[model samples]
Target: MPTPIPANARNPLRTFRFRIRMNTSAAGQYVAGVRTVSGLSVHVSPFEVWEGGNNLHRYAQPHKVNWEPIVMEQGLALDDTLERWALAVLEFARTGKAPGEAVKRDVFIDLWDGFAHPTEVPAPGPEARIRSFYVHNAWVSKYHALPKLDAMAGEVALLSLELTHEGWEPVPKPPASKPASPA
Candidate 1:
């Protein structure tokens, strides 16, 4: 038989939906019109820190943190802003010369509730700001704008970008602002 559920076990603040935003200081601005982003992938490199003295079992521990490249997918549009950005990174990767400057940037993911009137992250109310995850020092690792046409030519074009980053951490909540005193 299954055990009965507890009333206090459920959490009202739990969220399940989110929106993604990518910003790059290296590009001097954030990439606009991004449709979707491959969610965060983090790994902790496991290694043995302590050795056993003729013992059958050895203790192991996590040493380094590694983050996988995030893939940003978007519907190909008329604008070539993202294309140019990707090309710039490619130029640097291919040759020493870059068509334009390339810089590392941070990627942020904001959680949201579907019940909200306007479905967007960073909403005015604190309820909309469920949780924020951010990755630091990220750059484009690969870009694909190739089209596969085989009776699917009528389908919308899409662009896939792989962003390699160092590591990610949860964004801390902002402190409450104090009211100003009368002059």
Candidate 2:
């Protein structure tokens, strides 16, 4: 069975290391790190601000934000899938909150069998760009049979500080923000 084409191939979401700077005079550059997608990725974590704190003076709280595009890039239906991922993430960034789990529903999708095929990429070490990917094994098996451990999810070993606050509750209500005007 051949792979399915991305229903949304025309325009995929743009995932990047985005930094929202809270500028300060001279050079006190404060920033908000975030992880966002095109709004279809389900079960995605939401956004939260990094309030200040420290641990025994060894490290101070990261006042700025740190972000990444969370979904894996297994290509194929890459465009459509990424769009969903982007939109979901963006919603979180603006609201500084996660969409309630009750509002999320998990659906499976097809992706490359990289986890099952080591030669496809490489022995992902602690230095690889992507850590892992989830394959709808139902789809994988329907297309190609698995010879070994029938696994659906594959993870890479690389480490990254993704999503500044994956588990921080927003204030009673986030202060309303105004749209940015042209500089």
Kindly provide the TM-score of model 1 when superposed on the true structure, using C-alpha atoms.
0.69
Q: In candidate 2, how many Å is residue 106 off?
A: 6.0
> Which regions in candidate 2 have their CA more than 4 angstroms from the true location?
1-71, 74-78, 96-183
Against the true structure, candidate 1 has what lDDT?
A: 0.66
lDDT, residue 103, candidate 2: 16
Q: Can you tell me which runs of candidate 1 are displaced by over 4 Å? A: 1-19, 25-30, 49-52, 78-81, 116-127, 175-183
Query: Listing every candidate in turn, what is its Cα RMSD in Å to the true structure after a full C-alpha superposition?
Result: 6.5, 22.6
Encode model 2's per-residue lDDT on 101-131: one tens digit a residue. Answer: 2112222211111233222432323222222
* Total backbone collisions for each predicted model: 1, 19
Tens-digit lDDT track of model 1 for 44-114: 87786555465666677888887877887766774465677688787877886856545465667676544
